[model samples]
Target chain A: MNKLMMPIRGDFVAPRFDLATEILIVQYNNGTLLGEPKTIIMDRASDEGLCQMIVEEHITSLVCNGIEELHYNFLLWKKVNVLDGIIGNWQTALEKILDGTLQQGAVLYPDEREASSYESK
Target chain B: MFTPDIKSLLEGIPCPAMILDHIFRIIDMNRLMEAMCGHVTDEVRGIHSELVLRSNVGNSRDRLFKSVMETGEPVSTEGDILNCYRRKIPVHYHISPLSNSENVRSGLLVVAEVLHVEEIKKEQSNKSFSSAGIIGYSPKMQQVFNKIPLISQTDASALITGETGTGKDKIAEIIHNHSPRARFPFIKINCGALPADLLESELFGHTKGAFTGATRNKAGMFKLADRGTLFLTEIGDMPLQLQVKLLSVLDDKRFYPIGGEQIISVDVRIIAATHRSLREQVKKKMFREDLFYRLNVLYIHLPPLRERDVDIRYLLDHFLNKFMTGLGRNIAGFTSEAMETLLGYKYPGNVRELSNIIEYAVNMCKKKKVGLEHLPGYIFEPVADSPVAAGDDEINHINHQTSQPQERPPSLVVLPEKTPESWSDIERQMIIDTLKKHNSSRKLAASDLEWTRMKLWRKMKKYGLLP
Candidate 1:
């Protein structure tokens, strides 16, 4: 079984890790989810507090967007598999992560062609 | 919530434009808005406007966005917004209430004007507090930086006093570079490096046979610096006999070469520096009072690095970036624990020592981040327990085993079940083992450790291994 955490804003991944206050945690065995995903809302946004929670919860993986190198390195040192720079709906991102198809810098928005066009330029 | 007519209206706008529903969710955005926000229209459609805009002004609950929707009035303000990549961009935005054909308010229209975002980012990145290559932001350093230009315009003899490695020589060069005499030569002589007679001969020219070893006539530093600046470093170490000659030359702008009769006149600006207090030296009758008065006309003193509050962090990052580029290392930064250890250390050697420590750490770091193990062993040594007198500039010699009584307890040290082997112990053992393997040859040992001979020699001396 693996536990994954994603900092979220509404339906999408939060644009910045440090600014995120809402988190979604879920546990899965193989390709099947064991139970309902849990939502946790912090009183305020703090990268350090979030890191402490991640460690205490024993989260095996983290998916987020726009994380600073300091916290990223800290999480890496903690042995958490970090998939950063993800965008769009958290549900689709979670699905992709479960199937092992999601990669870092994945933009799951419906307008993939438009996002790619801007990125290329 | 966005009507086709409203979407078309947004597309007609010249600048970046978007429409938000009554709930503050983004309804639709024009192509220009998509480019500015680094997101496509479909990506952000129906999302909360705050999630997409990320304005510095609090959220949709803030007065700017809420007041516009509630009162049906337009609000124009200047602030910052985060793009899709989380980069803050300065902008001026106007939010106005949008109404249907029946005159019923449905949503709000927002138009943005980016205010030189790229230029503002560039300015912020380049806004380090520094002057003439000297990096310091403390009030004391700022006062010193402010005085450099004013003193540079004058020809008066200037005196600079600071602890060793506080960049006294760099300050002198900056003054000379900014002076009117910058076009001519800038010469420097260490007053403490030579003996009394040799120092005298170095200051004033000497004819052939001036001394037993003088086989040829040579120009002195004063002659070499004619019409320019002559920096006299470690001026307090100059012998008393030589001080009188320096005073005479400062007053008359003329001096005779040794073994020569005619006095040679030269126009030169004098900048003197010393780590010791000239006033204390005068009280002890070691330095001449008359010469001290002459050199103290324009004075500047640099505070030690430990006294600088925020500058330590700034210099750490500065030197880290510096050495990273020079060494071609991809090291990102120091770990949190390493940063804490570095910040807690009292740098007795001032800025120069901090720079050297960073260089050594960067060289030693193998991973992306510099860990506590990568730092030099000396930094972990405990500071002295003696209390420092307020306003005193002296540095107390650090005692490795003692704890500071007056200051807060050191952050990293605590009573433990078992004290781990300190980096100092590890380093000493490594040096000893390496030396034995190299057959006690310093050169071979240094090479094996990938350190310079001078570095190895200094380390050996620090460890009391010097025979």
Candidate 2:
């Protein structure tokens, strides 16, 4: 029952989503947010039916590679936990979640140390 | 009986029978026997059956015949015999000892049936196996069918770009089926089908304990499509991070499964397809530029169905045949009006959508021919019926453009606003009135509206046409 969620931004997600019809799924746990990182297809960039489906499915944590503002706000309004800015391999993001190292909310800046170390290099 | 008649009777017998003496010597033969032996000769008669079958008998024949004769059981042979004079022919020969009035055994009677070689070869050549599940006959499809062999000859990575339902997958299949590696498996994995992590494992097989769910070792699509083709449908949807990994695989031909140390290598041809403009996705920073450039090597842009209006009738007939047998129906075809209606609409879903529509229509159609009245109401409903509002906006825009008194716009300018009236108004007031004066339908409409029937229909629909 360790439900997880991950979002993928591009069509390159291992499991590609149909762009014409957006049908994406999110994962969650009991009261706690475990990133549900998954890819999905979309009819359009809209989330009218998607948000309701997520709430009905009782998804707690949504971990996606990216979510547009409209869908992001809709999920937030439903009180579903949202995690963003985690990138790289989808499983790696899930591992970070399991290890309790995944920072809550958006980590917009690519970590400070990693950025500074890159500058030095 | 006459000697010639007896000879003819012997030749007419289908069985290749021979007469033998007490010493098992050949006495007489028929024309069939001669043909079976490739030609009859005088040396062939009065010879022991052993000598005649010497070059043809099996290594175990003598034992079989001796045991049968000693036991007084009929010696039956079932095996192939290589006739020295003729070629090898499978023969079923039965030998029985002829008894005299005293019940003493005399000569053996041999009856053989030679199976023809040509008949078997003909049957084998005429055998028809079921076709693989690819289907299409439209001229556009015919062009694709023609391109399949050409695509197989090249080794470059191919990019299949087309609207959804354009049969990109079928195109990939055609390419693979015609390729040199057709015998190998053609693995397909939608880049957007799986989670990025699971997809990596799926593509490059994972070892046991590689991760929590990695119970046993698994082979990826690359392994399955080794030396064959890997069709990546919606490659445009691949995750950004995985895009980098995929790029690496394309360049180095190697990748490691999730949590696995060893890097596995595979030789698989990549054929990617997408409806979305990859250039737009790359600019949005959702797709990698390097990967797009890498995969965009050989681009094939399949034209949408709306672009090929001539193919509509061809596709309609093709689909009718496909679904008629499939649905267990004998519907004749589409009515002329239905054909005109179908040819008029701009199919947004392209071929796939058209197929679905036809399937729906076939299910709904009860009569022999599918007519316009039987068509889905949505098809006939103007675009104004939908929330898209594109039609209204375009009309208003045209009116605005036409109202500019500086220049007299073309006749089609006022077309949008004037066409929505009921068809009865048009037929009664415009068509019939004009026809009464001109005494001709075509000449009247042409002179009055300055347009043809096709153009009239366009005008009628623009005016909320009834008929």
Candidate 3:
């Protein structure tokens, strides 16, 4: 079976091992936790294109330290698995997960459901 | 036979209180209760407690009431949002088992009091604070506001000069939102908000090993704003030494992020704003003159609120309806006297201060309309006295020089020694020598003569051979 694809933070410089086939590592600015940090030039087919790269690159998993809920859901809907709370060496992380040595920490999904419940209380 | 005594006992409790019989029928209500629900008392009295509290009769309130009746226990609940006579209000309800001297369950008594509606409105308004974020429509503001879209039409740097709180940041936002690169990124850095070292690191970013606290490589504002627009607010506060480096970036879009050897090439548009006069800062040696000129291209000056007297009333109404809706109050509007006072006072904090004043009045108002009584105490006081007579004289001199042409033909009765004339004059010879040294370049000649380009152009156009 094809392994799940997750994005990793750019600062996770070391290569760690996990069950996933490969880690979709990325570098981005603060506040924008998913996808390309740039909003301009992303929709186009020319240089620095965003959508084209996401589709053509055969990306499957995104492992990051922190990913915004919007981006996490977008990746998941695109047939990509999102694994977060992983930092440091990418290779070691992958090996630890593959060999059952890494303690998979809890990944936080933003409590979007609580936002609407403010009126209830 | 004892029912009359029981009803009298229930009416003695203060506040809007109600008592219900064993069948959940309201037996009696207090004097305050009658005044509060005066017109609707007939329909409400002798009605089942459930019927009075529950209009739809099928919602969560009914379910809780049924449980309270069956269990024979006093139950209290809070915040059942309901639409009462087209006004949204929250009510806290209390239900208790009615008992006689024998301690047997007779019926249930329910009571409620209306919480402060203003408090709920305040919370709601906090959620909608983006009203004045930037939707200006006044003609004077429109003139400046309209030019914002034009800012993003080109990559050339723009400088916005205005008094504080004139919506300079909003103007910057308009430029970014309307630009060709709007979707990319628009980052703003307040130059005066930080110290020199911190500001530099924020603009240029730093490498992991660049500084003491540098733990990881960080992207600077310029790099983050790459391929987009970077708004630098309060540029006048930038240190003189940093001004030189910034000028180099304006001259050539190249810079090395701190501690990194890579020469990053960024296609970024710069939009800078300041409350201080850059020209004055340059003269004071606080700002670099060359850098000032570089950013001065496509200059925009926002008139202070005092100058745009027409916007006060319009903004006042705008803010009132805005705050009222946000506070969830059907406030008809501000009283004429209150609005007049607002218009007469010169807003030292500009539009921001005006919004604050309206917000403050809205919170303090007990009636539907804001009045002079609700106005802040300071609005009525005389403005502070001032002492800048020397500065006033300098300002007058500037105005005087600006009004009259600098190169007007020497007064008809000019002093012969002061006005040099003649074909072979030393001044004329020196002009020719400098002109030749500049290789006949008008720009170069203007620079060498220490004159404005416009002045040199006029001179050349007058003398001919400007090309």
Candidate 4:
């Protein structure tokens, strides 16, 4: 069984780890859901407090957007696998993590036509 | 809404360009920006700009974006942009407001230009003058820095003189840290903090049951600082009776604890500091002449922050960066008007006062830049036109004016009703008035004025007032 936590805003991952106030915690076993995911809302956004929650809850993995180096190092030191700089929908990122294909800095959004057009310019 | 015209405009820009909504959420970015930040536009289309750019400016990004949108003006600043790969690229950002066809505010257009490494190197070189966390580049401070090594080589009793906030204690610690006794503990005691009788017991130690409340046998500061450095701060406030005992200890390197029959000896180097003139204290029969000579064998005087004119701006930048990171606030810098006020104001409390002012301003400031309104009110208080003779009316007036409602009340001590030639005169007069108001009780005066007893004592010594 693996416990994963991801800071979320609406349907997408929160942009900044330090500014995240709502988090989604889910427990899964062998790429299958074991129970319903839980959501915790914090009174205020604090990186230190979030790190404490992750440790206290025994979260094995953290999927987020942007994170400062200090907090990233601290999470790593605690032996928590951190997948940072992941953009786009939280649902898509979660599916990728379940299938064991999510990578750091992954952009899971499907619509890349506009991006491709801009690149051709 | 991603319009064709805005998309074309972004593509036309040569440098990295991004369009942000009024709330600073990334709406779209050109291919250059995507390449620079290591993210595709579709993936971060609705994400906040700070998450993608991760600029060193921190939380100030929101304020800068809001300012541009509201004021319809372009704002520019220099900082590092941390991309997805955690690479820091020094860049200059220019942000301007984007309006709709009806001229109603809509969003923002941000352009980023990467700066050359040589430019960053030039700025850092100017900050090379620092030692042991003590930063100063002024000539006066340079002289003090030059003398530290020479003074640290000897075990002689040294005297350090400076105003209350001139970093005397830091200098003493730096000297001790660099000295041969760096391996040993460095102990410090403020002479002005305790009464003579209590100070005697604290310094020389007391036997169990020697006096009331002496429940256990205690090791004196001298014992704790064996083969180390003992720093005596506010030495001018050492009572006249205790001066003789201290003098004896310096000569014989031994002392008897109160009610102790055993002879205890300790080898400890003494470093004494005072905001007062020990020579003048000796002349007034308040300090012992022989003891003054013993402590003054090697003297180092620290000039006040005002005298080190060049250091003010340097220290301001240093403390700004310090507090910004500590508080997690992304303040770019002080507004020109705020900087002018800070530079022009007389720091009556010296470096300590300046540091406090900056901390307070940083906490109050909410925008990208700190403005004059964010500064403490005392900086703007009007100085008196002439020296009014000491009276109740003037004191009451000052108390009433400075008592204006604030998150932290300004000091209520009455200033000498005149454009005092020096800040010291104002501080001295204020201390005298506060002491008199509390019937000369140091504890009461300190409590009433929201200052530490040691701070009040140091100020009294600086003003040559008897405790």
- Top candidate, metric lDDT: 4
Considering the two chains of model 2, state its CAPRI-style docking category: incorrect
Relative to the real complex, the DockQ score for model 2 comes to 0.01
Stretches > 4 Å off in candidate 3: A1-121, B1-138, B384-467
- Residue B84's lDDT within candidate 3 is 21
lDDT of 2 by residue, B1-467 (tens): 33344355556667765655444446666765654443363545543343334223433555555555567677777664433221234676666655545765544444463434333452364221113333445455455555655677786788877656666777787667656565456778777767788777768777889889776666677876777789998787888888988899999988887777888888889999876668777878999989988988876656556656677777778788888888899999999899888888766556766675677678789998998766666567543211122222322322232122223233311222112232334454675556556775543565587764334534444333321
Instruction: Show where candidate 2 strays beyond 4 Å.
Output: A1-121, B1-147, B383-467
Q: For model 1, what is the error of residue B30's alpha carbon versus the real structure, in angstroms, after optimal superposition?
A: 63
Candidates in order, interface RMSD in Å: 12.6, 40.7, 25.0, 11.4
Residue-by-residue lDDT tens digits, candidate 3, B1-467:
45557556556654445666544545666655554333244445554443233222223545565576678777776653222211223455666666677765544433454444433552365322134365445556666755765666888999886656667888787677666666456778878877888888889888989989787677787887878799999898998878887888878898988899988888889999887767778888999989988998877766656666877887888888888888887777778898789989866556766776787788789897899998877668754321112122323322221211222244322211111222224345555677899887655776888875445544544332232
Evaluate candidate 1 by giving its C-alpha RMSD to the native, one decimal: 22.9
What are the per-residue Cα lDDT tens digits for candidate 1 across B330-360? 9989899999999988765667777777888
Error of 2 at B228 (Å): 1.1
Query: Considering summed lDDT, which 10 consecutive residues are worst modelled in model 1 chain B?
Result: B394-403
lDDT tens string, model 4, B388-432? 222224223222322212213245322222224235666777788
Q: Which TM-score values does chain B get in all models? A: 0.58, 0.54, 0.55, 0.57
TM-score of chain A, all candidates = 0.90, 0.52, 0.42, 0.90
- What is residue B61's positional error in candidate 3, in angstroms? 39
DockQ of each: 0.04, 0.01, 0.02, 0.10
Candidate 3 accuracy as TM-score:
0.48
Error of 2 at B136 (Å): 7.6
